[model samples]
Target: MDDTPTTTRPPRWLNDHEMRAWLGYRRMRALLDLQLARRLAADQGLSEPDYDVLTSLSDAEDHRIRLSELADRMLWSKSRLSHHVTRMQQRGLVTRQECASDGRGAFIVLTNHGMATLHAAAPDHVAAVREHFIDLLTEDQLRILGDLTDTVLAHLREQPA
Candidate 1:
């Protein structure tokens, strides 16, 4: 028997409108993330990941949460979260305590310094958002964009990696 690769059907490509929309979305996302990170770093001495981790901890009860739960909430890999946590710990922004019930696990607790930093950073972050994003959109546009975001996010979540 011959062992040969068989040809499949041609790939489905995005048409003009779809292509424009997809590319535009990609560009906007990339630029927005870059700008946000830059502004945060310049104005508050915080990176985007720092802000995310800090905010997650701040929102948790007692400003403390398990490391695994934080990783899941941040949508970050274990290794990624670990490294960031270590860096933040060095900066006096957070502390990790061994879990009493789980010897192998730990909890991330936001420190007073972290809370102070977040409180200082939040207003500037909000202003940046308004300047760069929210102010540019009308109320109707904001509502439609929000709905579109939710729809796309839900659909993406249903797909396999």
Candidate 2:
């Protein structure tokens, strides 16, 4: 082994303002997610993942999307999406159809029941979001938040997987 001495650089720590902003953002994200999840479960008998999948499928052409594509869009692993899809299939919310052109590929299709569930949940979810988060922000704050999130997301997307 070579005997080159490595010099370690110290991390640039967050200052008070940055620390406060970071911590506040973390806390807000956690609480907002929890509140939204609770409201979805209590009002619609839907978990966040369930709602997410349903909404995604609902937005797709013919209410169907390729499994792999859906998994990528949802940021879920193939195995996890398969398991969740199995559960959704059991509940009659979704069904999988074998792709005609590719034997190994399948499409996730939203059933009528799933669409109905999403329709029922949308109004209450929007109300809850407005009440808990959106209503708390001024117009300028909302615009800034949107810009901030967009910038962060763009940076993250550029990084290696």
Best by lDDT: 2
TM-scores for all candidates: the values are: 0.93, 0.97
lDDT per residue as tens, model 2, 24-141: 9999999999999999999999999999999999999999999999999989998899999999999999999999999999999999999999999999999999999999999999
Q: Candidate 1: where are CA atoms >4 Å away?
A: 1-7
- For each predicted model, how many residue pairs clash, with residues at least 3 apart or on different chains? 0, 0
Clashing pairs in 1: none
Give the TM-score (vs. native) of candidate 1: 0.93
